[model samples]
Target: MTPDLAPQGALDRAWQRVADREAARLRDLFAAHPAPILPARAALARILAALILLGSAALTLLGLWLLLRALGLGGVSGGARVTSGLGAAPLLLFTWVARPRVPRVEGTPLPEAQAPQLHALVRRVGEAVGVTRPVHMVLSPDANAFMGLHGPRRTPVLGLGLALWYGLRPQERVALIAHELAHLKNGDPTRGGVVQAALNVLHQTVSVLWPDPVMEARAGLPEKLGNLILKGAALLPLGLIHLLLGLVGADQQAAEYRADLLAAQVAGSEAKAGLLDRLHMAHLLDSALHKQRHQPQRPDAFAEFRHMLDTLPPAQWAQVREEHARLRVRLDGSHPPTADRLRVVQAWPSEPLLTLSPEDAARLDAELQPFVAALEAAATEEYLYRTSG
Candidate 1:
């Protein structure tokens, strides 16, 4: 006998109701603006902020140099001189703050020779998006796909999420790739990196000035007061840096909206929208799976994901959507709400230029099978370790 899917049916109805209610507004917004345009003020603010940071660092170093020279002149008592030298400790903090650190990416590289068809697909997508192909492609365990610059040379690397790939349709996968490639075409990675570096400096400076209370608890009252004074002094620059980061983040969000439009152009609105929906559902299910005390052993991760999707009740899906709808975008967030993204894409006129045949999808999956198997094993082991701990 067929199992009851009344809950699932109800959830589908609920989703339709939500989609329908928001459809007109989405369409109108798209009609007014077919493509996202970066706000000029935000762009200017980002550039100005970068310049200010550079100037501030230079001024700080000059001040430290003058202070060291004055200390070397030694007009005061030895004890006073030692205290003056100690006063320069905050100057040393800038070195920690301004030090440039490369972003660490986790995953195993997939050689082009091992996946010729996949590489070809990426090349086609890159061409359509007017961006150079990534120098390397890596398979990640997370349910996400992104492109980034790595190392001193800032070489572009594409990261394909195994779980995301397994859960999405072939065309949807193409749309995901197109979206990431759009980031490269738009030069978001480089711009975002600069903003991120500035923010990191600000954050580290704040941490140094206002260390954990627990760590400083045993200090004398005078020492505590001095730390508090330092924290108060650091707040102004921190606030300014945060504001600047917000402006940069707005541009980043605009870039994301633009990428969605580009993805729709490459893979069609339906495919892009479908991919978003599946991703939302997958995230919900993945969270639940993560919380389970005893995970089911599955050799094929893709098949396991398929089974999870097939068996998930509609009521649970509806709950996930409802909760998702309640999420708000923060001022410093790089991406807009997924609902907004979905609405914008849905309003876009359908024009799919890429389609993969079932056989082609199967071939791609076959190539990824070994990698997926290894990823799943690692994920399982990690989960076991976490649960046991």
Candidate 2:
């Protein structure tokens, strides 16, 4: 694409190589300095992200004002007004699509009264990680966990994936909590309003331009042609996304390693690395969960998840790692490659700073019992619907 007529697969193949190389480079950076400062490029990316957000907002407003002036005050002819409206329609649609949004965590909300034990563990992990406890608790069905600032008030919320929780050891569970809590301390600039808004704007633009295969099947010839043109138009936004990734990729990775460092500091580094390793095997859990649709009886999804992990062969584990090695991380992904993360945490090994004992973990499990079956049912239903009929 650099010469403007490059081979079709060249860019994708090259990027995969770049990803592999970049991960090793970042691994070396972590090995050399366990604690990292934000690079100058990341600072520049922040400014550009802010500009992109502001510029889009400004252009939308300006276009709207000019259109309204021509229509109402300029006393334009009916034909002229219609023409102007048609010309402004696409811009207006993009403005509406790309409006700033408050993204909410989609999960069952866990009140403090209902989940006192879980709340207590959250508080303890918060203290261990040197951050205030997140006020809201969420029970997600997926095999991932996150803690983030949400809403206008930026109230901290912790969402734990029940499936992932089922598979983790007690100390590894502590590591999961610590990792999320550490995002509050780590300098992940994506947490800021400007960057988040900018990302959302770009994401919405891409969504509008990307030709959905489901819809494409029903499209007429003219519509299909339009989709092709729109797909071509997508190149600019995609390039901007790549630019954003290039500038902030290493810097964002540094934040992740920093958070991993905190996790290692709180929960044993070995446990932290173990958690990352388990996370990489998430697809195996996903496959098993989806298979519940064909089960002879209603299966206990949590038990199935744990059993899958327990029974996985050594060769299967290596294959899983190899499969993940071939994958690439895009800008929108939550974390760097798991192998790179594992390397970072493994390099700085430590014993448990905050352990979750078997007894306490059992108590916490009891607190989650009511939500467990519901989450598993919901997750199984979702996986079945998504993967098949």
Candidate 3:
């Protein structure tokens, strides 16, 4: 990838121009496909309302039981208590079942001296931006680079991609690096990383507890007539799963937007515009189409559990092992719909884009302010949202 041989001040000015261009681009994007901010806000409000309602209901229930005992109208009912206890069992089971396991990705550091070209570029960029050089560079097939704070000091790791390395021009590569560094400057990664980790664990737990049969059995009880009213509490964990996922999706999108703005500012408007178009085009041609091509070989978690069970019996184990072998094929699934991504990029006002009238530009800018504000709000909430159980 080509590094900007220009002086640091020149790079900064170029970056600022790109940032302004990106702000305009985002404005156009918001105008073209207005995000349903009101609906999302209403949904968020509803969640808070539901939480309050749940607390009130719980308090009311407790009050009713206490009043009954004081009036001598009720006392211990063994059968009812037993049924309630049975219903509460699943809720207790879920506490443990829905917890996430941290994935053990071994930290692999690459030798820096081997890639003098990259080191020189990063060093220059870091010096210009007033940030530390990346602690390590990793080569992975995935189209991603993240900066995060880990351990006591919150060090940075600049993970690179083999695909990006081969595909992007040197200038574009510099743009990518700038984008990641922006994330560090904005403190998005360091602030939001812990929440992401927590949600991962929560998702894993919910996946275990919300199997079809268990969910079906959970729905059989009526709330008004029985002590086993909470039989359907499994739905709580399921709802949490969706909430966690939505938060992650929204945060990721905002993070990308911020990074785009920052990178464009760092690398210059021309480079940013070129890189955006190329990145979208590359994704459309390569990764976007191939996203869902590989699936895990096992049919489901059931198959994994059954295989484990069968291992206890030599006779059954062989059949189970064979089934596992046959199922080892991966299912390819597409990531988020490409149509949405295409729409977003097309809406961006890059260099070659059609010129807008002064009035049209003003209109688009006015429309974008709220979305930009919403993005900021989402960014603010991300840290708290991620860490909450």
Candidate 4:
């Protein structure tokens, strides 16, 4: 009897050791370290604005000088001075003042009475890791949800799309939110958004300088000049630079797996296991929606090949649908291919899931009450896939 009791005690201690080790690893992974140093987005924006100002100023002066030269003032100013110096400054000012501002929409807040359930979920998970409740949550039709800075101090915005929720079970949905919160805690969303915004501005500037019209002039002085500037700017290697950003972005995506691990540890393994399946299902649903909205080209191979990969053959539409079904991952506009994300999540280690402490669970239940009510009241809107120009 003494020997039997000794073996049982040893087994219990061994299991406890394993659990401790796993928890320690998770804690380190989720620890809120200072954000990784990257180019400051606002600083970069200011720098870009300054460069534009200087360039426009120089161009204006050059145009002025050109105008003077045209009137027999400076060195051989050949060709008509079609551009006006005064006009150039005003044009620059206009561009500075007015550009299409990316519409900033706030996440819809669940009613105060309803905030308990969702809030509790976030609170339990957040308090467990020592972070604040998320600022707000949004529901969109697209199979997408992103965490990002909503305001000063980089508040977290959780866009939990309907497609994502529809595809996932309750447990999986909780895991997804947990994963997003982890991103907020890790500070990746704000950092990534900054990098993304900078890249976007740079790409926009390049496009403005020498668009396709210059290329279409079919070989002349203006064409040559435009080509020269375009070629030089091409040195920026937008594709390669974006690839590097994608890698950093992928690192953040991998961070999703780490977050899932945390969720499983704090919430339970059932939530974690369902993640991959739910993600794949959501991807499929989104792809189907996309196809329905965009009429696929006829099945002619030539037509399909000639068009962008996105424009599949109407005949081969069935095939395309089949391929997408087999793929089992969402094709995100920005993130890595769906298949790849699924693979990463699938590879994550499996361990016994842990539930939040009783107090935390109760709090989570309370906080999520409002969201649950909203979810119940919300009608299942049909997915209408449309791209706005």
Per-candidate Cα lDDT values, in order, are 0.69, 0.78, 0.44, 0.47
The best candidate by TM-score is 2
Q: Which segments of candidate 1 are over 4 A away from where they belong?
A: 1-31, 36-38, 63-90, 189-194, 210-234, 284-297, 300-302, 381-389
Q: Which digits, one per residue and each the tens of the lDDT, describe model 4 over residues 197-283?
A: 445444555565444764556778887877887767655635533443433442443355556556555545566656644443343
Candidate RMSDs in Å, in order, are 7.9, 4.2, 20.9, 16.2
Sorting all predicted structures by lDDT, with the top scorer first, yields 2, 1, 4, 3
**lDDT of candidate 3 over 1-389, digit per residue (tens):** 11223335976667545533433343345436434131143245345435534543454465555445444455647666555555545544544454434333322344555555455566666654456746555444433455654454545667664334334444556667776776666554214444444445445554654445554556545523232423254466556544544434333444455455556545654555445544433332132212212333443222222233323456554553343222211011112222223234334443311122345434423432323333323322442354455
Candidate 4 accuracy as TM-score: 0.50
Model 3 stretches with alpha carbons more than 4 Å out: 1-108, 148-155, 189-194, 212-235, 244-252, 283-389
Q: What lDDT score is found at residue 86 in candidate 2?
A: 71
Best by lDDT: 2
Better candidate number, 2 or 4, judged by lDDT: 2
lDDT of 2 by residue, 1-389 (tens): 02113235977668656755665677688877887444587777779888888888886986686577557658878777777677677777778886777866667999989989888887888898898745687888888898766787777888899989988889899999888888887757676656667777788888888999999999999999999999999887788777776777776777788889899999999899889889877876666675564572334777678788888899989988886665556433446777778877888888888888999988988888889878988887788788785
What is the Cα root-mean-square deviation between model 4 and the actual structure?
16.2
Local accuracy of candidate 1 as per-residue lDDT tens digits, 1-389: 01113325776657444434433343345546976344465666567657756965775775576467548664676776566566556565665454546665568889898998999898888887777756578997766788877777777788997878877787898899899888888766234455656665666666666757876787789988887898897897688665775566556666777788888899888889888777767653354345332465555555667567657899987777676655544445566667777888887767888877778989998988878767776665665576676
Deviation (Å) of 179 in candidate 1? 0.5
lDDT of 3 at 95: 42
For model 3, give the RMSD to the true fold.
20.9
Backbone N/Cα/C clashes per model:
1, 0, 17, 22
- Give the better candidate number (2 or 3) by lDDT: 2
